[model samples]
Structures are given as C-alpha cells and as structure tokens.
Target: MEFRLLGQFELRDGDRGHHLGGPMQRTLLAHLLLAGQAVRTTDDLTRRLWGTADSSTSTLQVHVLRLRRLLKATGCSATIETSPGGYRVNLGDDTADVTEFHRHIASARNTDDEVRELHALDAALDLWRGTPLTGVTADWPRFPEVRALTEARDEARTRRAELRMTLGRSPDLQDLRDLIAEHPEREHTRHLLMWALHRAGRRKEALATYEDAYRYSVGQLGLEPCRQLRELQHLVLSGG
Candidate 1:
C-alpha cells in the first residue's frame, strides 16, 4: 500500500484508491502517518484536535477506529497500533509519499554524481501533487510539518535547476522566468534566469532582468541583491 500525504491523504492498495475519510479523519491520519512508529500521546493529540475541549478521548478513539476499519477494508498493510497513552501507525510493508520524498532528497544530497543526483531530485519532486495537506484545515495551529514539506519542495526545485545549469543541460528559460516572477526577491533564481538568458544569446534580456531586479530590490526593500548578482550583471554588460 502507498499512502500519499503530500496532497490529500490518500491510500492506494495496488490500483484501488481509498478516501481515508473526511477532514478531521484525514487530519488524524496525517498526524499518525507523520508520527510513524513514534507514539503520539493521547493528550498531545487531543490538545491538537480539540484544544482543551471536554470529552475528547472517546471522540479521538472513534476517529482512530474509523481509520483502522478503513485500512482493513482497503487491504492496506498499515495499522494504527494502540500504545500506552496514544497510538502509532505501523506501515508494515507499506510506504508514505513523504517518506519516499525525503528518502529521494537524501539520496540526491549524498551522491557526488550530478546526473544521478538530478534524477533523484526529479523523483523526489514528482511525489508532490500540489500544496500539501490540501483540503485539510491549517487550523490545527497550522502544522509545521506541512510548512516544512513546502520548504523542502522549493529547495529541491532550486537545487535541481542549479544542477541542470552545472551539467550543461538545456536550461528551461520559461521555468526560470516563472520562478523569478513568483519570487521577485529570490536573487538566486534571478541569477539563474540571467545565466540562462545569456547562454541563449539573449544578453540584452539577461542584463534587463538584472536592472529590473535592482529596481525592485531598492524600491521595495531598500536593499540591493548579493554580490554574485552584481558581478553577473557586470559580466553580462562586458559581453563576457
């Protein structure tokens, strides 16, 4: 079985997909899956879900029971095991997308081979469907886990683009442009966009990106870009 938490909480046992359940149930499952074998104490979970509300233990149990029944019905190998004070999710022979994503990223980080690392990054990034925990409320005090996942995704994307440039691969200019447009303050992606434009023999456009970035930084944030960007602009100006 494969449990995907990068987007909606979904379980796939072979070709069949299981809904898991509604918002609260999905949130419960997400917490358990992220906790892995580590026991999330009953108090901790109740605090997260109910926040000092009265009569939460039985309610929490009902959610867990429903999750277990759904897992059983779907033939998923994962089980929600009861610990002394709380529960733990044991994946058995199953896997979670978040785990796989992190594993691939770690593999990429550990390898010296650029080509191999790039492929690993690709695998890692492909696991994301969209904004994580989609349709799940950010209201569980806005899960830090979800925020970390998004940050990981952005870092992976940036690293992959940098790797492509290093390997002399054909730069995806449009992607770089899109990234910069989304993050005008990202000097690194601006650098990347300029480099790609220069390599494509559009030195004029590359220099223009630097000028635009300069104006944006100074006008909005009262700060200039880092030294690398300025140096790259000089290099472009000199036709180097």
Candidate 2:
C-alpha cells in the first residue's frame, strides 16, 4: 500500500486506487498516515475530527469502518487494527509520500549532494497545495506533521543559501539579500547575506548587515544573535 499526501491525497493498495469520498474521510486518512505506526486513541481521533464540541463516537467509528473497507477494496490486506482503547493503521504494509520525500532529502543531505538536494527540496516545497488541514479545523492545532513540514521548508532554504555562498557565486547575493529583507527576524538568512557581502568586497555593508541582524534578533525574538554570526562579525573586523 502506498499513500500520497503530497501534491494530492491518494492511496494505492497494489494496482487499485482507494477513493475516499468525503472531506472527513480524507482528514481521517491524513491523520493516520501522518501518525506513522503509533496507536491513536478513539478520543484523540475524535478530538482531531471534532474540537471542543458535540460529536458522536459512533459517527467517527462509522467513518473509520468505511475507510477500512475502502482500503481493503483497494487490495490492501493490512488491517486497521482496533484495540480496547485505540486504533493504529499498520504502516509495515504501507508507504507514505511525505515519508518518502523526507527520506530522499535526508539521503541528499548525508551524501552532500547539493544538486540533488536542491531538486528534491523544490519538489517538496511544491507539494504543499494549501493550508495543511484546509477544511478540517479540529485537526489544526497540535498537528506535529504541520510543524515538521514548516521546519523542513526552512531547512531547505538555509541549505540552498549555504550552497550558493560556498560556490563563490556573487549573483546569488541579491536573492539572499531579498530573503533577509523579507524575513528580517531570521538570523540564519542574515548570516548568509553578511557572508555574501563580505566575500563580494562590500565589507562596510556586511558589517552593517550584522548590526541590523543583531538588533532585529534582540528586539523581536528577545535573543542575541547566534554564536556563528557573532564570530563572523569579529572575523570581519579583524580583516579576515
């Protein structure tokens, strides 16, 4: 069984496709796929399906049952196990698109393959079509996958910045400058911009950029600029 939540939500068990009919069904399936191999209680699923409001447990069970039947019909033999207090969709027989995506990214990072990493990052970024939970408000808060994806996107951006700087590519400075302007609170972006400026012989501008980054970090996040940035500032002053 293969599940795709990137680009579109789709499930394929063997050669047959599982067509989950309603928004609720999609949400349920999404939660299950994102949860990995963990057992999610009925109450947990119910809260994600229907917030602090009235909802029938039987109704949720009905949805789960229907989803199970749909998976079975699609040729997935792995069962959605129901225990006394909870249920878990066994992932041993299933593959998630998001999981595959992260795996590819991790591989790229490990091998230091900048070209492959950039391509995979772009593909992963494109996978987000809209707000994660779109029509499912109950599932909005405390969704770890949503946070994970956000962090992944940021990580991709940072990696791209590092690669461009290391390549001694000057034209890439404008893009990084724009990124810093847009995300003034991001010290990582500022650090890259500073490095780009210094490497391009714009020493005064680079120092000024560091000052700005320090001020922004202190004012907005109530934190000092990171050690790397501070060290870079000192190195620049000493004519490094």
Candidate 3:
C-alpha cells in the first residue's frame, strides 16, 4: 500500500486508489502523520479533534475502525494499529507532502550555493497550494502542521532574499518591494528590498520602504521589525 499526502491525501492499495475526504478523517490522518512513529493517546486525539466537547473513547475507536476498513477495502497494506491508549497508521514509503517539503528544506540548509538552495526552497514552497488543511478547521488551528507550514514559508522568504543579494541585481528593487507589499510582516523581505534600493542609488526610496515596512509591521502584526531590519534601516539613512 502506498500513502500520499503531498498534494492530496491518497491511499493506493493494490489497484484501487482511495481519496480520503471529510474533515475529521483528514484531521485524524494528519495527526497520525505528525506523530513521527509514536502512538497517540485517545484523550489527545479527542482533544485535538473535538476540542472541549464531551466525546467518548468509543467514538474515536469507531472512527479508527471505519478508517481501517476503508484502507483495507482499497487493497492497501496500511494498518491502523491499536495500542493500549491510542493508535497508529503504519505504511511504507511514508510519502507525505509535508515531510517531503521538510526533507528538501533540510537538504538546502547545508549547501553553500545560494542559487541551488533557492531553487530547492522554491520547489518546497510550491508544495503548499493553500492552508495546511483546507475545509478542515476544527482541529488544525492547534496542530503542528500549521506551524511547520508557517516556518517553511518564512524560510523560503529568507532564502529568496539571500539569493537576490547574491545575484547582485541592485535594480531588482521592484519585485522585492512587491513581496514586502504582499507580506509586510516579513521583515526579512523588506530588509532585502531596502538593500536593493540603496544599491540602485535610490537611497530616499529605500528609506521610505523601511518607513512603510515599519509602520505596516507595527500596525498589522503589532510588532516591530527585527534588529537586523532596524540596523539596515539606520545604515541606509546614515548613508552607510
């Protein structure tokens, strides 16, 4: 049996391909995938899926039973194993899109070449088409998947900034400005934009970009730009 969570959550058991749907099912599967070879307790699963609503352990067992049957019917070898307190999904290849993304990112981290790292980071970012769990909001708000996706996106932004600096397109301020406009809370992108503007001999415009970014960050995220951004802004203003 082959399980895939890269684009869509899918299970291929022999000749049959099963598309897993429903918010609860997706949440259950995602929770299992994020556990990383550990068995989750029933209480934890219930809390994650149903929040504070009073639910029985039997309810979780029923859901697991259904999921196990569904996988079996699909001819996949995936088994939902029952432990003393919880359950686990054991399948081969372990091909999850989220996992693949992290693997690529970790591979990019040790490389010295910014161009190649940027290419790999972009590919990892491309795996995310939307929110981590589309149509599934009940349980995802507190899940690790959300945090993982958020960090991956931020890492991609930082890598892009580094790549742009390495390419030395000082006049590439336009797109960097656009990126900041789209993600004003991303101070790193704004920092890179400021540098690009300064290098292009548009010192005043660069300063303005910093001002705009500062205001946007304070207003939108209720936070200030990072120290690096502040330092860059000061250097630009002082003609350093």
Best by TM-score: 1
Candidate whose lDDT is highest: 1
Expressed as tens digits, the lDDT of each residue in 36-150 for candidate 1 is: 6689999878877776645469999999998888878878788999999899999999999999998999999999999999999999989988767666664632667666777
Candidate 3 per-residue lDDT over residues 115-136, each given as its tens digit: 7787787778777665565544
Ranking by TM-score: 1, 3, 2
The full ranking of all candidates by lDDT, starting with the best, is: 1, 2, 3
Error of 2 at 38 (Å): 2.1
**Model 2: residues with Cα > 4 Å off, grouped in runs:** 6-19, 52-56, 72-79, 90-94, 105-141, 163-184, 197-215, 218-240
Model 3, residue pairs in steric clash: 6-97, 13-75, 13-76
Better of 1 and 3 by lDDT: 1
How do all models score by TM-score?
A: 0.90, 0.64, 0.72
Query: What would the TM-score be for candidate 1 when compared with the true structure?
Result: 0.90
RMSD of 2: 5.2
